[model samples]
Target: MDRVRRAARRAMFAEKPAWQRWSLRVLMTLAWPVGAVTETLYYLSVLPPDEIPRRALAWADRGGDMLALAFSRNVPPREYYTYRLHQPDRRAWITACLYAPESYPLLSWLNRRNGADNNTVQDKSRFADLCRRHELPCIATLAVFRDGSQLWPATPFIPALPLLWVKDLSGSRGAGAARWRLDAGHYHNGDKQMTFSPEALARQWLPRDCLVQPCLDNHPALAALSDGTLVDFRVVTGIHRDGWVEVVATLGHLPCGGPSGRRYIVGAIDRNNHCLISPTLSGFQIIKNHPDTGAEITAQPVPFWPAALELVVNAHKKVPEFSRFVFLGWDVAITPEGPLLIETNSGWGAFNHQRGIGAPLGWTCFPDIVAEYLDFSEHGDAACD
Candidate 1:
């Protein structure tokens, strides 16, 4: 069945946008070597034992002791997570996802949920049920498994521009993701359709060990970075008991799309179904030619800032399932309609760029807020536990 579809895709893509068709072909061809190499290095253990840990420690030493040890540097591919207890017996090596009695790993890593903000998404499991009671739609995210043994393959859409993604399902990294198309998956019919609809999306649902998620479009708003691009926002929000949710920081990203698009296009980033921001270009802009396209990063204000915040503030009341945390980061898209959710990540980063970008224009207490969340007052001298 899959064999017949592969043959059909060849015929379908034979006559489409040259850039679109050729780009997908080039991408598929290009990824082969990368996949081969990752298989090589990953199998070969390219990462040194202390490589990630040392980087974390170095970052801590340089950035002051606030978040020093909380962001455990090394995350084992499968097992082995660095564990620090609430009392601090130094860092302990435990299995990943092994939170239990007296373990503070879950909360410790919560502060880093957003790359540029110290916040965490409220767990929606409880909130999902609440939404059910209220007759609201809530989508649950399923993890894409290690083996492609899904009962359903996501019906992906091939975009004219380019889509951004992070693979591995553990963490988001620039090197971790690349553009993928229908060519990557197996299918029933000649599966090279331009866009996969809801029926197709479910038909590919492998629902085994893979992650099953609601279509991001179901959120209030949804749009590709530029008709086809997946470049999106990683926006942070803070909620006060006073019922106002504020956009503390936003990490507008343009993934490795053409170096040109990277320079000019800033996509959406969301914290949850609640809030997100679009690149209205804010204060400054990057004035470089894209390595791929040759466009320049133009400056504009953050789009729908006011409306986005209102959604976040009212999110708990709206979703009710995500009311666990007062703060969180969302990868959002601000469409012609409104703000929408991309997905929710538990461990997010707090800085936009690792090095450059100078100081932020607005308040800089995101880390401070994270420190407060970590119960810094009680820990006293405990490292990032």
Candidate 2:
């Protein structure tokens, strides 16, 4: 009976026309408000007794404003506070929610129109191969594992490196990422040690497809700012209508020691001079010096700034396949040799940009660029909404 019901539902969905399917998706997208309100209530419930009343009052006061923004600007209710949109001055800033692929069908359509069809930037293994083919500066993949079996290095032995970094091939936001260190001829990963042969350990440790690469160190000038992990920069670039690529914004991922060990704080970089400024904790509170190292974040300009910028811009131009992506966020590492490409993001979040700069992108020329690329006339005001 259950199988029959499932089959009927599948057939019903497949029988629907394209327009009806699209409308269903739109309806589902519009339902996020209920989830958003539920999330806000849950957050308030967890607050201390005295804090709940104040926070709840704030939420209530912003109810009208939240609804207006949602209808007019397409900002999700939860993002209103998450991006600090309640501040009158910040009202003009666009929320990251506006570009979420799940919620905004127009942007999703634009992504496909712009060349997302062949986008390999999201897959680590494929991206590495693309970079290598183009002679682009990037970390080389040592080996690949899939389903607890070796898929690369035909001989199937782990590379003999002092340190190695393992990451899910298609994961993001540092999910399922870990570092392995060679200690006493054995690999140590947190509390787990490589007690078996290297081949056996690789199979045991990896349950999903992943890539293994050598762990890199921060350039000496910026080493102190990094609590012991490699710190990378998030460089955003966009291709204009005329086929020229430009750097839009830059942010630094500074590593700091936390109770759990190493964590990162994002800071806005002076686009012109490449100096770190306006560092923040979780995009909320402004921070001055590194909490763990006490190194002044803005003390010195970032090393290899020009080279880093050039690497990404040139990469966009050199790879014709990537030209379809109007915007890309590049994760670049600075090494003694120069800047190395870490990865590329086709759908980068705007939270870091707005929080680091303390302004909405709407106030800048970003909207104009997007509107032009998307050709807003076809979709009318609905695209903006």
Candidate 3:
């Protein structure tokens, strides 16, 4: 089935004419409404029987308002509850579906501009190389594994680090990411153990292509918020036509319970004041303390907040390919020394912004910024060098 889908996609691009390819892309974008409806129904299906009517009514009201808005495209059910779209002024919130590159012709064009591509941001290996070339502070890959073989180090095992993170080269949202602790001269991840050899590790946790990097430790001030898992900040940066870069939104992901639990409490950080506010669990329930440790969520401002923002903004400027993107979502870790770039997402979602701010991005300057990029993509000769 996978091979058939791959071949069909290849033929769609290679056999079809440019016009047909674009028409298909447009058709896919137009099909988003169907997905939205399906998603809405699926969300309702999971709710208790008595709660469905109220939630369904809320969806209808909000879905109608979203359809009525000029900027609103698809009404994501998750965002509806996350942002409390049932309340007034829900039209300004943009759904995650719009972030899909093929959702708009101009977005796709922006992605393909100036030989710039999402690979430089999406692929973990490529992103690390870009950071290395630019001398940016980013998590370094100690070794890489591909096709059941070690691609780096030429050794059977990577030099043991106290902790290591193995993640899919092109994965996102912590999907297919794992943390291994070096214990008793063997790498352990849960009940599974490996002999430090790539082949041995692959048998346990590798996913065809993965990067092994030394796990970063959280800054001491922020350590109490999590159970040893590195909590990172999601900083959204936008680049202007004039070569200026600014942070559009900021949020912190605090891993609650523990690293093994794989749950996070996301909080919105005020980009202007650099203070944490609106801590939420699963994007809906507002909370004031960590569920596992009972630590105050906003007891103190984020440590080295200004420096973290500066690092991401500077790092974004260093990568010219990112200039073509509408906005880059930077996962930055605040270590005791300073901030380090974990990874970047050219196609970052809007859920964190909407959920954290408790309002729609449409209510802010984001739509205008997006419009500026769309106009540039339509008229600009080339992406920034």
Q: State each model's CA lDDT, in order.
A: 0.37, 0.68, 0.66
TM-score of 3: 0.77
Candidate 3 C-alpha lDDT tens digits along 61-150: 645654443124434565454454544565343442232232233333445543457677878888888888888888878887777667
Top-scoring candidate (TM-score): 2
lDDT of 2 at 280: 81
Arranged by lDDT with the best first, the candidates are 2, 3, 1
Candidates 1 and 2 compared by TM-score, better number: 2
* Model 3 clashing-pair count: 0
What C-alpha lDDT, on a 0 to 100 scale, does residue 188 get in candidate 2? 72
For residue 272, give model 3's deviation from the true position in Å. Answer: 4.8
| Runs off by more than 4 Å, candidate 3 | 1-78, 89-106, 154-157, 191-199, 202-207, 375-385
Better of 1 and 3 by TM-score: 3
Candidate 2 TM-score over all chains jointly? 0.82
Question: Which ranking of candidates, highest TM-score first?
Answer: 2, 3, 1
Error of 2 at 11 (Å): 25
Candidate 2 per-residue C-alpha lDDT over 1-385 given as tens digits, one digit per residue, 9 for 90 to 100: 1121122122222335867866765775578577656655554444435434456567576666666665565555556655656666665555432323222233344456576643388788888888889999999788887777777878866556888888888868876787777766777774463354465557655677888999998889888778778889988787877778877677898888732566677887887777888888656557788887888888868889999999999988778766677777899999888999999887666656766665555545555556555433432432222
Q: Name the lDDT value of residue 319 in candidate 3.
A: 68
Please write out the lDDT profile of model 1 over residues 1-385, one tens digit for every residue: 1121122223323344777876776775566444443433352243334433356655334233212222232122211211112213422322112212111233334423322222223333333334445544334333343344542225442222122222333344432333333334422222233344334543443332223332233122222223234445565565444434555555665434442334333333343532223332321332343234433433233456556555544553355334444455666555545555554443344323211122221223333333343333332432231
> What's the number of clashes in each of the models?
46, 1, 0
